[model samples]
Target chain A: MIEIKNIIKSFNESTIVNNVSTTFLKGKTNLIIGQSGSGKTVLLKCLLGLHTPDSGEIIYDGVSNKKMNDSSKTLLRREMGMVFQGSALFDSMTVIENVMFPLTMLSDKNDEEIREKAEIAIQRVELEKAYDKLPSELSGGMQKRVAIARAIVMNPKYLFCDEPNSGLDPRTSIIIDKLIQEITKEFNITTIINSHDMNSVMEIGEKIIFLVDGEKNWEGTNKEIFKTTNQSVTDFVYSSELLKKVKKYL
Target chain B: MFYLSDIGKYFIMIKMSFFKPSKWKVLRKLIFKEINDLIIESIPIVAILSFFIGAVISIQTALNLSSPFISKSLIGFATRQSVILEFAPTFMSIIMAGKVGSYITSSIGTMRVTEQIDALEVMGINPLNYLVFPKIVALLFYPFVITISMFVAIFGGFLAMTFAGVPSEAYISGIQMEFEPYHIVYAYIKTFLFAIILATVPSYHGFYMKGGALEVGKASTLSFVWTSIIIIVVNFIITQLLLS
Candidate 1:
């Protein structure tokens, strides 16, 4: 579980992440849905300890990220995994090497063990054939899958994904989203996703947090999200053309 | 002038960079992960640079020795001294500044632009300590190697001159006559310091880079400029102190 309380982040004179607060539930896909520049990414970064909140506290499990020592922060990180927006696979590494990076960096596992674990993680994502391929050799969807495998190979207690479906086609995006949902439930990990895609929300957003200009405007389950009529949330949800067509039927 | 806020951030970043050595594990991972890149990415350029430098320095020393008053046998000795005292260290740093500095800057800058640096931080990795330290360590790892490589290169130039029917014995004698412990020591000290600066400056520029590919190019350019200017200026200071 993760708790963020009254986090404020600013650049120059402008406040980027205003006094926002929310909790990401364990064993569920907690989706933070917002438009670009809505500060969802910033909030996620704050939670990840990438950007220090100007004021407020983020608790990973029970440890306050703002107050932890370097070792503690690193220890916390070893328990967390991230699938980056661009896949961000180590370009120089082979697919297996990419999957095994966390093990190599964080675990005391031997090379054989690391390789075996990495292969399993890669295979779980159905990327067995691509183990020898570089990230550049993979399609957008495959890269995301590899990134997902890398993230989970460590069996992290927390998994963070930033726009994992951003560049992929609709079918692949659904597959990636469902994969994240299944992984979160199976591992019983606290998974947080910063996403704007409605299809993902409908498919895997167990608990949805709508962020508008850095504030948490609405919080509900995916099923309740459609029924509750928060104007800003509705406007945001319908603003997408795909969601607009979905809205006409409702 | 940049804002005071930027200055403050710079100071904080610097503090984190030097004092936070606990991320040595991350540094090790970065080094091992990219070893091939560091070695393979750099060789062809190093070969071309060292070859040209060796040939040119030897030729220059030979041309200067055309006066009959100076024994022709001194040319080799002079070339060796020149390479050790100046070319092997200073010019090597310059070549490394071009190759390594730009590479570090562009690579780190690219990481920054692409948010991979952010990803590291999200994983609670110290971006600088993780990324920059390995490069700094690599510079430390290979400075002596590069110096030796440059030495071999300059010696090759001597061989070229001799094989080309220009007198070669004079050059070898010239190197022997001028060879001194103090001179070699001084060059080595200068070289070690240059290597440290050469590693740090571009990484610093690259770490703070913003925007897209254009910013990466700018950072790369700045790395070269800063590394070059600092190397030359430091060379002068070291020269003055050593001479004094």
Candidate 2:
């Protein structure tokens, strides 16, 4: 489990993530949902240690980020995995090589052992046929799967996905969402996804934190989201006409 | 002020790149790959350009030394001196600043735009150590390329003189005249320094670059410009310090 306490981040004089605190439970898909420019990415970057918060503590299990030195932080990062929005696979590397990269760099395992592990992760993502294909040869959905395989090959304690569904079709988005949820459950990892996709929010958001501007405006489950009377939440959750019709039925 | 901060950042980047080095095994593979990419692949262009330029320099020298009073060997001597002292080292490096420098920038900039650098950081790897250090190691062999350039260029000069009906013996003797070995040393020193600039300045631009595909192109242009400018400036300074 990861606990955020009073995290405040700013750029220039304007705050991007105000003193927002939340708990992301282990073995659950924790979603941070907000509109564009609403601090979702900023908050996610803070969690990933890509951006340092001006004030507050992010405690991984019991260790606060403030207490960890650079090496310690790096060590901690080894236990974490990230799937970027663009699926950030190394363009020059093939699927299996991409998945095997972290192991090749960080693991003490022999080549055969590393290959076996990478093959297992590839199989898990159902991308065995694409083992030798470069990222450019893969489709959008296949690329995201490769990214997921690479992220999970290390068996991280924490998983972070930054808009994993962006640019993907609706069907592919759901599959990616379900895959992440399943991975979170199977690994019992603390999975935090930064997204604005309402479908993802409803499908895999076991714990949802809603941000308006830089502050948390609402916190609830998907079921709770539909029933909540909060004006801003309703306005966002049912912003679309199709969603409004669905909410009317609900 | 922006330049000052960027300069400071460049130093800091170099410092950090040496920190927390990657595993030697992985770095070994990366170094070999970079050597193949940056050095071996560049040989054809260097050889071709040197040959043509050397031929031109010899031909020009031969035409200018048509006076019966001037020794015909002076044409070969002038060509050899010009090739070794300035042309091979300075001109070739300026050309590489366009070729190799832009390549390093665009490749790394593409990585940045695509977030591959971020991915490395997330994996607890030092992106600089993983990416830049190998390039530096690979380019340490750059003098090998320069040496080839020097030999091919002198050979082109020899061939050009012979084909132009100049006495081959006179040209060969001229090339052997007053060979100050220190000039070769000075040229190599410049070559080595240019190699470092070729690797680092482009890397700095690429690594720190922001934005998308268009920005990557912009960074490549910027890197090439900066690299060429630095090479020329450094060449002037080294020439003044050593030759003068």
Candidate 3:
């Protein structure tokens, strides 16, 4: 489990993530949803240790991130896995190689063991046959699966996916979301996803934090989202007339 | 202040690059890959350019000698002096500053734009150690490339002089005349310094570059320009300090 207390971040005199606090439970898909410029990415970056919060404490399972030294930070980071919005697979490496990279770099496992582990991760993502293919050869959805495989191959206790379903088709998006949800439950990992996709919110968001203009506007489960009285959350969630009508029916 | 800050940052990057690698086994592979990619692949171009430049220098020297008192062998002497002391090392480095330098900048910049560096960082890897250290290690072999250039340049000059009807015996005599072995040492020193510039300057540009594909192009161009300028300046300083 990860606990953040009063996290605040700013860049160039502009506050990007305002004072916010939340807890992300283990064995669940936690989502941070916000529109563009709503501090979703900035908040995620702070959580990932890519950006240090201007103030407040980020505690990972009872340990505060701010107090860790460089070596401790690296050790903590190794226990965490991240899937970038772009997938960020090494363009030159094959799918299997990409998945096995973290192990190859940080683990003492032999090559054969690493290969077996990578193959399993690839198979879990249903990409067993695409092991030798470069990232460029894969479609956007396939690339996301590769990224997911890479992220999970490390058996990370914490998983962070930044806009995993971006640019993907609806069916593929749902499949990716479900895969992440299943992986989170199976591994009992504390998974945090930064996304603005309503479909993702409704499908896999067991716990959701909604941000508006850098502040935490609302926080609830997917079911609570439809019934919430918060005007900003309702306005953003049901911006389309069709969604508004659906909300009325709900 | 910005310039001073950048200088500080660059040194910090250099300092960080020497950190203990997470896995030397993986680093060994990276070093070998960079050697093959950056050095071995560069040989053909280096060879072609060095040969032609050497031939041109000899031909030009022979043509300009109008004094009857001057010996034909002076062409060989001049070629040796020019190619060894400057052309083979400095000029060839300039060529590499374009070919290899642009490649380093654009590739790393693309990685940055695509967030691969972020991926590396989140994976508990120091991106600088993982990326730049191997290039620096591989480029330490750069003097080997320059040494090849020196040999080929002199041989090409000999061939050009021979074909142009300059007396071989006189040229050979000049080649053997008043040979200072320290000139080779000076050239190697310059080559080593140039190699450091080649590895770091472009990497600094690419690593710190912002924006997307267009910015990568601009960074590559800037990397080449700055690398060339630094090489020229360093060459002047080394020459003045060592030779004068």
Candidate 4:
């Protein structure tokens, strides 16, 4: 479980992530949803320890992140996996090598053992033939799949994804979202995804935190999200023309 | 805000720079990483110029001493002195400033502008330790690698003169006659210092870059120009001290 308390982050005169506190449950896909420049990414980065909050406490499983030693923090990170917006697969590596990177760098497992685990992770993602392909060789959706495989190769306890469905088609987006949902439950990991894609919210938003600008506006499930009378949430959900038609049915 | 901010900034920078890079077994790997890269990437251009400078310096010596029956013993000394003391260290560093330095700046700058560095940080990896340290470890000792190339290059001229059978023993003597171990030793020292400055400044500049493609290009250009200028200036200061 991860708990963020009074997280406040700002850049220059503009506050990007306002003072917000939230809890992410283990064994579920916890989501942060907001429009562009809404601090969803900043919140995710703060959780990852990429950006330090100006003043706040991020307590992870009873340990405060701001107070942890560097070694302990690194150990915590090794137990985590991330899929960045662009997939961020190492361009120089093949899919298999990219998946095997964390194990090679941080694990005591031998090459044969790492290879076996990496192969299984690749297979789990249903990308059977992309093991030898470079990231550039794969299509955009395929690259995200490779990124997913790499993220899970370590069998991490925490999975963080930044806009996993941002550039994919609707069909592929559903596929990726389902993959994350299934993997989250399978590993019982604490998963957090950042996105503005409403289709993704409806498909797999088991838990969602809505942000307006930089402040937390509401918290609810997919069903509750559409039912909320909050004007800002309505604006966001109805802003999508498809959701507006869907709103008529609501 | 006005007067001594630059000096104060340098002091703060010096203090922050002291976060002794994590001691890791990875540094060994970094050394091998640098050696492999330098061998594969840098040798062809360096090889082409090695013997050319060696020959030119030898020719210049021969031309200057050709008039009178110069001391045969002085021939090798002259060859060895000019090649080892001056051309070997200075010229090779100049070449490296172009080839290896530009390559480092371009690569790190591209990664910076592309948000790849941020991705690494989000993964809890120190992009500096992961990306830049290996280059530092590599280039720090890789001057020795560059030095090895220089040994071949700066002596290629003497070898050619000897092969041409122009009283070669005499040329060898001219160079050997004035051979000072400290001169070449200082040469290696100067190159080693240049490698550190070259690796750190450019990698730091690239790592902190915030803008887009044009800004990345600007960082590379700035790193190269500043690194070159520092190398020349430092080289002059070292030469004066070592020679005196």
Residue-wise lDDT of candidate 2 within A191-244, one digit each (tens)? 999999999998998999999999999998988988899998889888899997
**By DockQ thresholds, what CAPRI class is model 1?**
acceptable
The residue pairs that clash in candidate 2, if any, are none
- Give a tens-digit lDDT track for model 4, residues A1-250: 8999999999897899998998998988988999998999988998888888897899888899877998888888877889988888877779998888777766788889999999999999998898899888999899898888888888888899999997899999999999999999999999999999988889989889999989999999898998899999889888978878987996
Every model: Cα RMSD to truth: 3.3, 0.9, 1.1, 3.5
**Which DockQ value does candidate 3 get?**
0.86
TM-score of each: 0.88, 0.99, 0.98, 0.87
Model 3, span B126-148: residue lDDT tens: 99999899999999999999989
Residue A63's C-alpha lDDT in candidate 4? 91
Error of 1 at A197 (Å): 0.8
lDDT of 3 by residue, A1-250 (tens): 9999999999999999999999999999999998999999999999899999999999999999978999999999998999999999999999999999999998999999999999999999999889999999999999999999999999999999999999999899999999999999999999999998999999998999999989999999999998899999988899878897896777
Here, model 3's chain A TM-score works out at 0.98
RMSD of 2: 0.9
lDDT for A74 (candidate 2): 93
Model 1 agreement with the true structure over B1-244: per-residue lDDT tens digits: 5756655765566567655453355566667655545544666666666777777776777688778787766666666766777777888788778878898899888888877787666555567777776776666655555666566766777776887676666666666774578987898789888877877888878998889999899889988998899899999999999977
State the TM-score of candidate 4 restricted to chain B: 0.83
- In candidate 2 chain B, what residue range of length 10 has the lowest lDDT sum? B11-20
lDDT of 4 by residue, B183-238 (tens): 76787888788777766767666766678889877877777776778788988899
Per-residue accuracy of model 2 over B34-149 as CA lDDT, tens digit each: 99999999999999999999999999998888799999999889989999988988899989988899999999999999999999999999999998999988899999999999
